[model samples]
Target: MDPVTGSVAPRKILIACIGNIFFGDDGFGVEVARQLMIRRYPSHVQVVDFGIRGMDLAYTLLEDFDELVLVDTVSWGRPPGTLYLIEPDLELIAQAGERGVFLDAHSLDPVKILSFARSLGAAPIHTSLVGCEPESLGSEEDEISVGLSPTVQAMIPAAIAMLDKLVAELSFAKKVEVTSKGAT
Candidate 1:
């Protein structure tokens, strides 16, 4: 028996972390997603640590998902260890635009992935981002940057808290939407 055929579709939620783990702060997404998976999130939440694959993100989004959260280290002109939340600003994003960036360790850039998602109509209406100041982009030792340092690691708890809240909001919202649709 195909269990999935009879089962209710999992209410989809995708949390994607995109970065190069070898490049210090650039690895924030992979690390955070890794830690997050250790927890018991709702059955619907699917977390993926996309390491440095940006262009491929579009394919992932093609899956049925009510909510999607993308995680990456972003430079907001802030000093290292600083963390920032990127509000869903499609215009701001399109304006900022995208270009290919090569990592000594990996492939693809976040902007390119987002751009692809946008073009494909695969984007979730409620999208958000967490950006961390990158202290180191390249180094042989493969150490977390001094700029990101110990202080920055402290931010992970807060970021996780933020993720929890967002998930709850989307979960509740989806429920309400589904209920409303069934009623009509």
Candidate 2:
């Protein structure tokens, strides 16, 4: 409860948007953050465009959050613009760390970041990934492209809808947990 407001403070939720806007469809996460910013969210929800700053994201993870949602483009051999709600396995992330898989300073790898955060004894209680399949990563000329491909661009609405649903579910779960604790 907040002393000044005399109201219960909401559980903190961090929506980390990971992507490189210059790499065509790799900008999916950034765009999602942009769109979400214009909309209203619960007081405890923070939507940040982390871009490709892996180190910054790693440090930010130390600030505990009830939930962390990562938005990015994932290539799973699916059709372009396909959206996926993934629950990353923490054990698998730890295993990857043991295998010597590491994170690049300029690249945002959600799994790697989670593993690193765990190493530092700081990880969100719940972590989820909201990914979109990309048509292209702008590898043609090795130069940056400023926008998403048509296929990927078309799925922004779907991605936002999915995010809204996830946030609502998490918020409700948090409320239920608080109520149960009080009852106990």
Candidate 3:
């Protein structure tokens, strides 16, 4: 509830986890999403495992959400299982294609997806991504059943912890305050 107004202030935040489980460590997002499913959260926060479902996620992004927290694999050339919070510049992403992005059902490209969302005239919203460095992304031609590496698997708790903090900040954080003293 608003402290001053004594009215409820609900901020819609979407925690959309995207990944392909068949591609080894690429499944990190899906796993984190699964673990978060059982936990409780404010009604305003929605957690979804958008594994390999780019179209579903794209359409969902059209909804009016105050913010979006995306969970996915990040290959940053660092050690596997490294977590990082990324606040991407939406403008740069929205410049993807003049013709607009067309998402493949099996493909999961958060950048393109966001671009597509913007292309569809979706309003801009606060967006953040909780990412983990992937150790191995198995190929569909070979051993695609390897699943998440042990290193990445152990970091699920850490990811969840990060998400919790992020959600709290996004859901309940106050606006930045600025004041000026004149004629003092």
Candidate 4:
């Protein structure tokens, strides 16, 4: 079921954490998401950690969901811990474009992941990226970015704020749809 179209059973939202945690700031997305899961959200929201697994996202396409929010660490000229909602930037893709190069130490390349998701027809109503600056990408084995810069820690609140905004928007939309259907 395509979440963007709202024609699926069991309204659901997906929050995907796509990053390599051991790599300094690169793991920001996954870490933030972990923190979010500690709270209780509505049953409709599905939070998943897609750490360095690009191909695994393919399976996610099979699920019927109403929205998808992707969280990842990306360099957007902000200080470490700074978060940004990244739209598909052609220039950035072009700058980082190299055949199969993982965006960071992580296994999945960010651009490729988006492209793959599109090819599979997995479109969501609103897809947003929350990113943070990295102080250091830790060793390969640990893959946990260490000593998240002060800026990076500060961005967590803003990131959570964005999630809250999305939740309200999605919930409102669902309510309106139900009301319209009842009227019909």
Candidate 5:
């Protein structure tokens, strides 16, 4: 426990980086994970690059964690490289039905993964996504691209900043929860 805050010192945080490195800007999440690995985070924080492994991510969700942060490339029809921080709506997930089906092995579908996890048992109470808009998912020749485009590459720092802010907010919320529990 933290004496100053009267709360637990660390809350388990799972940062799941989801994407396919072979698909140009779709590799954004993988790159973010690579960059974050170079830095240090609290011991309770587990950062992993799932990299198109939807099933693996679903299984990881079974582990106890206070929060889950998903980083990926999202197509929201904005400019290429636009960053977004979204708290996925559980209501929508619930409405989407519970089925653990994937059309492709390389598909990085968070909604499907979450549904599968929920079906298994419990999922993290808190979840957020740091997403980037992609300019191109592959090469002009319709072949797989190995790296991100220039615009997407430039947004990495911005995405990292967003992730940092989200982490701080989750930490504060955890402290508040502990303080309230102690008071009661």
Candidate 6:
């Protein structure tokens, strides 16, 4: 906060995109990160693509950021291409250390990463997640399907729109829950 005005400083946001392109629609985050990188965003907003690198992302999470937004493919029994925003319960996540802070070299586990960061004494960050329903993900060891399904690919623009809105709100010190509802 500013000492003179007693006003809070604008929050810095880290948009961490995680995915493995070989897992089909699981590559949503990677693709989204690529698209976001081509556009212009505020200096306070950092967009990163840590595809299948759990440890790299975890260390990045330890940085002092006011807001963290994780973008990935989330399956919540919703129709394919459905975009939803989820504000994770950080307290619950911290307590459920039952999952442990194990990092797999092949996948990105946000929960474990966050827990591990907290265990490392990093301060709690206000985290929000933006996920798209996947149409198909190659989860088989023998399967190496690449790229995103048509449905999930279509939602990239909506995801970018959501982040743009979020960045704007962060500057104003407001919290918002968004859906891909009006996004073209």
TM-score of each: 0.70, 0.85, 0.87, 0.68, 0.86, 0.87
Candidate 2 at 103: error in angstroms? 2.9
Candidate 3 per-residue C-alpha lDDT over 1-184 given as tens digits, one digit per residue, 9 for 90 to 100: 7789998686789999999898899999999999999999989999999998887887898998878899999998999999999986665565664556777777788878877776776766677899999988985556666579899999999999999999988887553221111111
Overall local distance difference test of candidate 2: 0.83
Off by over 4 Å in 5: 1-5, 99-103, 140-142, 174-184
> Considering only N, C-alpha and C atoms within 3 Å, which residue pairs clash in candidate 5?
none
Model 6, total clashes:
0
Q: Rate the local accuracy (lDDT) of all candidates.
A: 0.66, 0.83, 0.83, 0.63, 0.82, 0.82
Clashing pairs in 6: none
Q: Residue-pair clashes per candidate, as listed?
A: 0, 0, 0, 14, 0, 0
Write one digit per residue (lDDT tens) for candidate 6, span 1-184: 7999998777789999999899899999999999999998878899999888878877887787878889998989989999988877766666645556667787878888877777776667777899999999986877999988888998999998997887787665753332212111
Better candidate number, 2 or 5, judged by TM-score: 5
Task: Look at candidate 4 and tell me the lDDT of residue 67.
Answer: 58
Pairs of residues at least 3 apart in sequence or in different chains that clash in candidate 2: none
Q: Which ten residues in a row have the lowest lDDT in candidate 2?
A: 175-184
Cα-based lDDT at residue 168, candidate 5: 79
Q: Could you tell me the lDDT of residue 13 within candidate 5?
A: 84
lDDT of 1 by residue, 1-184 (tens): 2486874454467888877766667777777888898998877898888887765676787777766688778877788767776655554445433443223325656555655665566643456687677666766565544323454566777778888877776665633221111211
Q: What C-alpha root-mean-square deviation, in Å, does candidate 6 show against the real structure?
A: 5.9
